[model samples]
Target: MATHTTFQFRRRMRPHRLALATLAACLGSGLTAPVCAQDAVQTVTISGRNSANAASVAGFGDIPVSRSPFSASVITTRQLADAGIGGLADITRLDAGITDAYNAPGYWGQLAVRGFTLENRSNYRRDGLPINAETVLPQANKQSLEVLKGTSGLQAGVSSPGGLVNLVVKRPTGTVRQLTLGWADDASLGAAIDLGDRSGAFGWRLNAAYDHLQPPTDASRGHSRLLALAVDAQVTPGLLVEAEIESSRQVQPSTPGFSVLGDRVPDAGASDPRTNLNQQPWRLPVVMAGRTGSLRLTQTLGKDLQLSLHAMRQRLDSDDRIAFPSGCSAEERFDRYCSDGTFDLYDFRSEGERRTTDALDVALSGRALALGLAHQFTAGLLFSRHEARFNRQAFNYVGTGRIGALVVTPADPSLTDENTDRDEKSTELRLQDLVVLTPEMSAWIGLRHSRLDRRSERTDGSRPIAYEQSFTTPWLALSHAVGPNGMAYASWGRGVETEVAPNRSRYANAGEALPALQSRQIEFGYKHRTALLDWTVAAFDIRRPTWSDLGPCDSGADGCVRAIDGSARHRGIEAEVEWRAGAWNLRGSAMALKARREGAADAAINGLRPTNVPASSLKVQAAYNVAYVPGLALLGFVTHEGRRMVLPDNSLDTPGWTRLDLALRYAQRLGSRQVVWRAGIDNVANARAWKEAPFQFGHAYLYPLQPRSLHVSAQMDL
Candidate 1:
């Protein structure tokens, strides 16, 4: 990995230069520039709300969440800080509809929404622009995180039917300077600084952070650094230009998961939670670095019309290394470990892996009155290109290791093989409209046409694969205002996804590409809001085609064939509530899901529950301001997850578990500056539980929940 330092450095500098050039061009335009007013005074407000009242993730402009027709939620910066959230896995504690999906320590975050795993390439966005989600995303410079649950065909052309996550970048709000210091019981230390200012039609914001993280696991430690900048200029009264760029790097070793022994689940208390299976002396830490830039231009065409253009570029380079553990020495049984706690180990390493993404979008939005009806509409065109380059990886078998002993496996010395590259291009045209049918009723309709081209090449003498596809997805919804503070709505949508057969020797039709599959979703929901309370309830059903390996190939060989032969249906209900009064604040959410396979070629798997999908989940957070202390508050959180099926055949499962967290905060003024301090303990009871069990690559892996730990932080307005 270190051999490409020069190349990586040169590649990383291009985005910075491009961003600077764009800024210069925007400033040098002939448009007149005027002096702007001074920054306004800042005020503080205490509320129980976890997010803003509106969001734009649904691609219908900034609409009130209470009336948006789909289920959505937002987590604000204040909420994130209060809960000490560091990654996507922690976010599951705030929303019942989201859960973990193979998210391990020191690796990029992965999650599922509504019983479906989100695609890393298409289901994530930054400031409404697409970016690669294959690396660690820094949260120090984020304003809010928005989640849209269910099908998103209108918002994204090709995506998972589960949902999408959009990260809102922090903009230049006003003049401010803040500094923070943090510490954790696991020997982690961090510091951050945020600065922003505005002057005469121009504003800028900068954020930087550095951290040294040491998890509870033995011989596992890492470091991370980040730098981000954002700027905006009001070119004229009706024109605005904004740009942002960020660079970050992280080096950490990934932890391998535990597996079941024979037919029995591993004992939770047998090994310490701090045990790490990948702690071989010859193992190397994974290195990940990324750079991203974005630009936006908005112009007001008229009183009721606006035009906007957006462009984004991202590049990621990573070296993945791990001492992977799988299977056992038992004959005819390679899916689980042996009864003596022995398993086969492999020295795996893949270097010089690169992923890049580029996207551009142009949209027009306005309001009009025609045919005796008021309408709001948006029309847009989107284009995106993604490429991935990889070198043949090393997965040589090493000596076996016992659960409680140190393993000294020698590193593989084989040279890397030829390169493999994948390229994907997509174009989409979208249109959506909201029409007021009556005084209390409205209708929403949307449509999108997408074309995708994908190609892959292997330099190791393997045949190339390519495919082209086109699809049209439609969306419809109807909402009726029950009262001034309540609304009821129903929505239906369709989405598309592309699948390719694995390039393995066991599959007869290996490397074959299939046509895009379609997924459908239907939902009904209601929302109500008041000065002191807000609540929402929704029910949804989603269905999609499932692909798997069926025995007996067309070649008359003793191998399997890969194709779509089944369907998966997921039905669920979700509810959320928030209440704020004089001294107490409460927020909670709950979800119930039923996911099963149907119409399968194999009867043994039909009607079985999907792996890692929970039947029900609940989360709640409460805070109270002490009446006598005036500046002190206490906080508590509770979360519960139902049992989950661990295998495709429904032969193994993990039990349900509940967790509790407690915290406290103190805020006061130091002279003319504001100061705040926070402390929290997660998993206070020290209960050991299996968090998630995901079967991958012909093996089953079990991840344990984090042990009890304490963290503290302090911030000062300087």
Candidate 2:
């Protein structure tokens, strides 16, 4: 079978001038609507630090989460560092609806939200610009992580209905030099430095970190390094410019535990952690390097209008030389799946891949008047180009030998260079308005028009295959103040996801790019807010298309058959609460989901739960500051997820599990400088658990969870 890269959009027009013309037209239209000099536009700076319970993720900019007709969460840098969170998966655990899609620590960060997977192509952002989150993303230089749940089509042109995640970069604030030293139970040592300062009209911030961890399960090791720099200049009273650059590298030597067979789920104690299955450990470590740069400009065109422009470019390169357990041998026994594992381990050292991305966005926002009512409007244009190439091959490590045998380690192995390339581009125009219907009520209306083009080619001299499509998604919302501290809201929105072309082996229309899949959502919510507490309860229902793959057809000439049968329904209810009373802080979130596949080609599959989606989940955290012992605080947290289906047939499932963690923190002034110390124990119960993934390439895999781990760190201002 030929290799391929999907999930790409492409276009061929220059849109900067078009964007400018559109902006002018909007301004003209707004001027002639309803005149209201008293309701002129207000200059509002939107940032992650704008509010404690709000995020700037909507078309209308930052608004209190309670007032916005959506569900969202903000994880601050303080929360990240204080909790000793390692990656995106850990960060998203604060939200009950998000869970691990693939638990490949040190290699990738993948997640699912609200029973849907966040796609690698269009669901993640850095400082409001689309970015690839398939690889390791460093957290040391992030100010906050913001998330919008359920259909982010207006703010994000094409994205998963599960929602969107935006990482806010840290900017220069005040003069400070901080250093951190930490260690974990796995013989991991790490150090980081953060420096930032503002002077006159210019400010700069720099962050660097390096970590080395010895493999907890083998004699191998893993290493990672990161460097980030940002600078901003106040060129004039009305103009500001900022630039940022980031570079990261990682070398991972050990693969997380996996089940060799696609069907079996190993018993809790079936496999030992201290085992290395790869024949040659030195050749199995995956190495990755990535660099990103971005520039932004903001201009105050007038007191009532603000214009901003941003551009970003990124390049990522990876060398994937790892031992992958694809499936078990025909005669392998289920009980002995991992006991003395003998499977078709793929010596998957493909020629690796290189991905490049470029994006530009321009937006104008301000106050306007429509029908004698005060209104805030936002308009924007977005363009993005993405290209990727990968060399494909098959270097099989057959199941003939034992798990630890080195006899099959061939000398001078041959590699076949079959290159596959994909190109994607997208252009989008969006407009949104918030109208004050009355003193206690408001309506939000938004629309986005998007055009996408995608092309793919087998660089091994094959003709290119292309796809083009367009869509118009809309957002309608209503919010009303119920009382002094309460708000009620309802919303309707749409979402989109890219589809991969079927290969020759799978369909008669080989290499045909299917139309993008669509999803729609409706939600209702109530929120209560106060100086010391905030909570929200929301219920949502989403509908999306269902697809299936049928094996080889009887008539070989036509290849295989595929079908888009009907649709899937996902309904869920969620409740979230946060409290910060004097000397105490607490947070709790919970979700109950019912996700079922309907109208499948196999009638028996209907009404079954989608693979790997948990039906119920909850998370809670509490912290208390001890007044008697100044500068000291104690923290505790718990996370639990119900049993989830492990296969499309719902014949296999994993047991529900829970984890507990505890931590202590101390802060004090030493010699006019601040000093902090922290310690924590994760998985306090040392429970053994596994994460089930329904598909990777084409097979189901089981991921083992890490055992009890300990962490300690110290930081000091210099």
Candidate 3:
């Protein structure tokens, strides 16, 4: 590898120039004399590029980044491996506008994009089909991750206004067998096996892994396993079929999170993450289990026409026991002593949920001449159904005797049983077309008709509630070539999202679904493509409706509250750049945003900044290959997040923080086999920080982040 890298500084023609030169050469050869030679010569066409900036963007199939009307980012397998990313929390750091929203140990992959939380049910997809993301995700079996910023109404009819995430599964490539072993700080251990083979028209791939991780703060423990299989066959020269299935399970014992005290946010910077607040021995660890399957078929009708169909099904289940301190005493802020060193805690036990989902999509794509202009069009239909069942039992501690009153010991609470079930169905019809107006200009128009039907029921023998709604949204865009290497574009779109009903403890109409939220966005951007680099910059303004929980209702009922109406407006500018030059790879992104609530029923809360969203964020990454050592590379990254409001009223804020990460990788060839090794350290500066306080039930709950950690891994091919 050292001998293969010799360039210090090099310049080359851009991609646009290369294409123009190739076209000129072909024309100069004279088409009239190529008939005999063309019939005698054989040529092989390359499918996709192998460079970082040249790889095809995953979510849109064959569309390149330079041609997309909206801003999007792609994380390839090589980038994931170099950064040692193991979960969604780690992956979101790659984009400056993305952050963790509601992260609990062994629970799920919750995230926020562009200052708004991405809904678990409507904002996530696997291979273009909707899947449940309420539990731990299968990151080990994915080939790439794609994120589309702002509204994506043309593809996803009902979704959060922030953005959408799509996971691309690994497919059968070639015959190979590989095994890997990994170890990390805190007594963690992992092992995995990957195998693939092909014969004639059939091919198959399989992957399996198991991991056991000790608590990052000595207050938790976790165990997880995953298995994935994929099969594909060429039924004929113009037809193909594929199928995939996967299952995963995780068990983790977690410590309860810290909470605010009496309308005042606690000083999270002063608290130690090593402290164990909830030390009850009987509380069980959280457990999660999930299974999913998908099938797809494709048929080619002619040289420029194709038809595709897909269907998917998924199920997830979880059980948990939780205890956390709430409304701590203000006098002893350091120790949170109730009377001297003891406080009452919210003890939650016997919580469980089961979720099921089914999805189907059909699409047709082709090109034709319309109105004397060439046009590319795609028409599709989508249908999805989701069902959820939830159970919970909760209690609050109140001391009995004088000795036990002020200072209480940890004990199990007598919980009451409560059960509820919810069902949701969605159907959408979509059509989009790209028309060529001139040689260097184009126009895109799209429309979607969407419908949603929802219902909810409780076990108390009350009446069941149901709701139905419909919406029609449109999308429009225009683009023009700025120069040989640049393109400028502008777009406008609308979106819709479904809201889960308020909790029974919080509202009188607890199980009734609110009206679906409406959203709109407008953006302008520019993209540039070069031989070794690609860059994009965009500006956007977005608005959407939101709900806030007031303290309590006028009725005299314990734990009963009222829901307030409100809205949010966000404006931001973002830039991203990527490069893959010889012996050097670099990428970076930056974002600045102003996010605020408007039209709130409460005047004090109106015009206040949304909690947990930063005003500005930056991230940079660099990797370089060692010139003296064969197949050796060094990588480093820096991330910074601006100050964030920790309270809903914007009365308290947390200071800005920065984090550093470093890694080393090596690969070598020995005879007919290959060996690879990786070692990395996260949070190299040992920075202590808290991720965010997600809003729930009129309060923001605090979640502590992991401390500095290290991991090492090795792999061998047979």
Best by TM-score: 1
Overall lDDT per candidate, in order of appearance:
0.79, 0.71, 0.68
Clashing pairs for model 3 are: none
Instruction: Give the Cα error of residue 511 in candidate 2, in Å.
Output: 2.2
* Model 2 lowest lDDT segment of ten: 8-17
> Candidates ranked by TM-score, best first?
1, 2, 3
Clashes of each: 0, 5, 0
Best by lDDT: 1
Runs in model 1 deviating more than 4 A are 1-52, 413-419, 503-508, 553-559
State the lDDT of candidate 1 residue by residue for 571-671, as single tens digits: 99999988877767788899999999989988877889988888999999888877777667788888899988877778989898898988777766666
- Candidates 1 and 3 compared: the better one by TM-score is 1
Instruction: Kindly list the per-residue Cα lDDT of model 2 for residues 652-684, writing each as its tens digit.
Output: 778888888887777665564545667787778
The clash number for model 1 is: 0
